[model samples]
Target: MSEKVIAIILAGGKSSRMGQDKAMLRVDGAHLLLRVYQVAVACADNVYVVTPWQERYEDLLPVGCQFIREARYEGDDVKQVETHGPLIGFAQALAEVNVDPEWVLLLACDLPNLEVEVLQGWIEGLENSRAEAIAVLAKHEKGWEPLCGFYRKSCLLGLNKYISEGGRSFQQWLDQNTVDILPDCSTDMFFNCNTPEDLRRRLL
Candidate 1:
């Protein structure tokens, strides 16, 4: 089967530690989510932004950019929509993608340093990946960098099974699968704005 690529940018976080919406934060005169979406557009055939607030970002993106409403679960009798973190959010979006032999470029919305050329280079290597490999991701000292990487479309079944079994941690789920480590990547490329301090560091 021929390979097809698509991107999914997760933006449903509450930004509790950042004290503001990181996706809407401005960097170099561009919103964080818009910047990431542009980068994804450069390297992938299609780009999708997964967030709870679609109207907030709809005007920011250009034409052809799609939005996938982040899944929320009802909490208590009040039926408040509650986020279950990136893992669940990712699974919900992945289920909507209907491509065969697909390679999904998954990213967090706060990664402002992402470079289109670097991501394009990574996409070029997907064809060389092993048959058993389910994902191709950069590895840090702690573990695989799950957010900024690529996963096979075939992995949806395994991912859903893991989530149904109460597995939420990306690192935990990755450790149980065979993943190809991304080569020749700089740690700075994965730098994300999670807190005010991180935002300051990015600007400097």
Candidate 2:
């Protein structure tokens, strides 16, 4: 069976280290989010970006691309501010979006060099794999590449359950379920911009 995927781009994080929104950061004349979106469009038919502030990126998004306004969780601090994390935002978007597919292609918009070919290669591997796994994620020498991975829609319930029960650790959450880790994933495709040094390094 041909595996279908709904590409979900995660762009809702607070870029505290980067000193700027990584989504809007320019790369070779185009915004980072737009660059990722352009690559995502080539890999899947239905693609969406999930962000905390939609207006901040409304003009920067590529044409035909849509985003979900990330629902915030009340933080434990005295100020009672809202927090935007990958799990919460992912759950919210999956609940609100109408598109249905065999797998959810999760991506981080900060990856300036993420290629359409690499994304498609992962999908092909998933389709060809005989193992019955809930998700297919890439693992580097350091650890698993959680953001740039594929998750089966069936895992949504377990994921939300873990989050609701005070579980925020991504690796711990994955430990509770079956996941296929793709080895030898391209390092360049997963090179994400987290700090100013990453952008300044010209790694791309």
Candidate 3:
């Protein structure tokens, strides 16, 4: 059976620790953003790059996959930096689509270790379990990975409410909802690149 899902590539980050845009970083022959778009295409009917710097990635986004900017919606008082996280990106992504898509598969562009098999497993689990949300649990680690997860677009309402209440913890918002956790590999395969050294280690 076909599922009506959309993949929202959260690419609007400063990548301050990595000192560059992680989405533009290369792993294989393609840029990281393209690689992510490939993965998203494998499972989604449509995919989009949610970025604040659309110009920087205009060349990287796939021909058909759209580029939607988040900066356009930022309130006058909220600095760009203030709206730079995945939470803000996710919200903007939903607003741009303007539909409660069946599911939104979110992926952090710097997550080089995100295996397609694991992502497929999460999709299967979420579909089979019939849960409101399903996310990868950082096994043997301290937090839930809210970035690379399956969200029912409806969950955005609660998350938006959380933001209204000044809540910044993504995990906290997920914890308060009907969320299912998929056990992660012990080898830290879900590790995200946040530094040059991390990129070196993963690339080399």
The best candidate in terms of lDDT: 1
TM-score of each: 0.93, 0.89, 0.85
TM-score for predicted model 3 compared with the true structure? 0.85
> lDDT tens string, model 3, 1-204?
434568888888778888887888998667887887888888777788888778888777756668777874455665545545778778778777765457788877877766767667666655654454434344335767777777777766777888889887877777777666665546455678889999899888
Clashing pairs in 1: none
Task: Name the best candidate (by TM-score).
Answer: 1
Please, what is the whole-model Cα lDDT of each candidate in the order they appear?
0.88, 0.80, 0.73
lDDT of 2: 0.80
Clashes, model 3: 0
Off by over 4 Å in 3: 2-4, 72-82, 99-101, 130-140, 183-188
lDDT (10s digit) by residue, model 2, range 1-204: 567788889888878899888888998999999898888888877888887778778777755568787866656773454655887778787777677677888888898888777777777777765456778888666667888888887777888899889988777887787788875676678888899999988545
| Local lDDT at 23 for model 3 | 86
- For candidate 1, the TM-score is 0.93
Report the Cα RMSD per candidate. Answer: 2.3, 2.8, 3.2
